[model samples]
Target: MDNIISKLRNLDAYPKINEDFYSRTLSGGVITLSSSILMLLLFISELRLYLHAVTETKLVVDTSRGETLRINFDVTFPALPCSLLSLDAMDISGEQHLDVKHDIIKKRLDSHGNAIEARPDGIGAPKIEKPLQRHGGRLEHNETYCGSCFGAESADDDCCNSCEEVREAYRKKGWALSNPDLIDQCKREGFLQRIKDEDGEGCNIYGFLEVNKVAGNFHFAPGKSFQQSNVHVHDLLAFQKDSFNISHKINRLAFGEYFPGVVNPLDSVQWKQETPSATYQYFIKVVPTVYNSVSGYTIQSNQFSVTEHVRTAEVGRLQSLPAVFFFYDLSPIKVTFTEEHVSFLHFLTNVCAIVGGVFTVSGILDSFIYHGQKVIKKKMEIGKFS
Candidate 1:
């Protein structure tokens, strides 16, 4: 056992010091204390960082197919009423959704910006049970009634019972309801009166649009939209006005699910119309993102950059209509975010380096001080240095 102990002691990196050569100074003690404190502080900082999760980002080419993009939006039009405002979405592939209602909610706001009512889209009108007129007159008992489409009907049996139906029929015929006052359905349904009543009220539209992953545009226009001459046009006559206010405030506009540290550039964005008849356009480039949290939760979203432009309406020329248009194109590259924490082994290694490095530096400083003091003492005793 004694032979083994001798061998172990010889192998020790730090040998025991003899008491006769031992010396301690105030400066050395102070430095030792300071280095120890510094090492502890550094170790604590590193440990904290090691314990917390960090997000690492990587970019790759997106090769997804048949994936749909979700657009979540909340927009407020201070001058346009919910009845007059319409939502339309169309893609480069020729798919179109007019007066989009599903998954959409509309809030009626007073001039003060307070919400008065919250309801789904297309909730204003009550459903009619039967057609009111037969051959342009009231139906008699046991008489079959067929509403007229005012020359827009595809067949003689086609019926346009409501003002909206008549308008839709006209849209299909590539014709506008030039004079709603002359239409019996519009007069009875008080469509013109409804527009007048909603004047000065504001609308807050919050909805989600699910669209193809390809490039396309979605717009917020004053009236229902239709295709005429291969061009998208809104029924301006429905509002009983030639111009509209395209001013809007975007409360929230997110491309997909929210993730940690994700910032949507268009949130809380506002624009005031200088002219009543103007077009507000946003050109957007979308980058897909996927986030995987340390807890194994995943979120798929998109980040975007946008450029805005506005064009005033002109009478003679083919002026851009008053609307808020969002044209978005997808990026081929996709970003991935992963949350990770430092391993226990790595944390321990860093701690050891900090402790060993600081101790070695402090010991070297103490050793130099002690040796300089010994040399000076010998010089003074020999009377060779004063």
Candidate 2:
């Protein structure tokens, strides 16, 4: 045991010197004090860095497939009435969400932009269990009456019991309900009166749509949309077409789940139509983002960038109707952010480097000052110094 101990001590790199042989000077003391202060400052800086988390970002190719993209939006049309406003979404996957009403809320705003009433997207009351009419002649109260679609029915025995069913039948036939006053279901449900009730009012629509993860567009336009000759069209005369205004303000628009420090470009965006009849379009590029927190939790989200364009309507041309369209496409590259703290071993290594570097530099400077003074004193004594 004694021999082993002696062998280990022989391997020691630092040899101690006696204090009695030490020669300390004022310059040496000053350098020691300055170097100590500098070393302390450096150590404090390193400690702060170790305590705080650092975010590391990297880009990788996105290879995800068959995923669903969720879009959340809160838009306010300051000059469009809720009765005439409609929401539609379509993707490249051949899926369509037209006149979307599920989980949607609409707020009626007066001319002053203040909310007057808030309700779900559907304007009318619930569909009555009993049918409203059957044919040109009124059926007795005890008869099992069946409503009519007024030539829009697909089959002879088809029945349109409610105003919504009547509209659906019209949409299927590629026919716009040009005159709601003539439809018995519409007249019974007071649909035309509802449109006149919200005259000169605005609308605030907020909703979420779950769509296929592909390039697609969702738009806010006036009137109900239908397909005519395989082309998407909206019945511009459903409401007051001549008085349509496309001025709108976007309160919040996000592509996916929320994450910390995420920035969405289109939040709180606003646009006003300068032309009498025009269209507002937003082209958006969505980037998928994955965030890994220091606590081992991960979040899947997305960030987006947008560009706006306006197309004015020609005097007699019908290239497009007044609407706000958001066309989004996904990016092939995905960004990942990782948050982590410095490792214990790494922190210790840096601390040692800082201390050793400062100490070695200070020793060299002290030696230069001491030896320089000694040489000058010897020259002055020999009278060689002028």
- When superposed on Cα atoms, how far off is each prediction in RMSD? 3.3, 4.0
lDDT of 1 at 374: 84
Candidate 2: clashing pairs of residues: none
Writing each residue's lDDT as its tens digit, candidate 2 over 237-266 gives: 555347478899999999898988899888
Candidate 2 stretches with Cα past 4 Å from truth are: 1-38, 126-132, 358-386
lDDT of 1 by residue, 1-386 (tens): 99999999899998888999767788788889999899999999998999899889999999989999999999999988888889999999999998899999999988888998889986344234444563766756787656678889998789877788888899888787877867777777778887888788899999899999999999998777788999888888756686788789999998999999888889899999987588899999999999999999899899999999988877797767888999999999999999999889999999999999999998998888878888988988889644
**TM-score of each predicted structure versus truth:** 0.89, 0.83
Which candidate number has the best TM-score? 1
TM-score of 2: 0.83
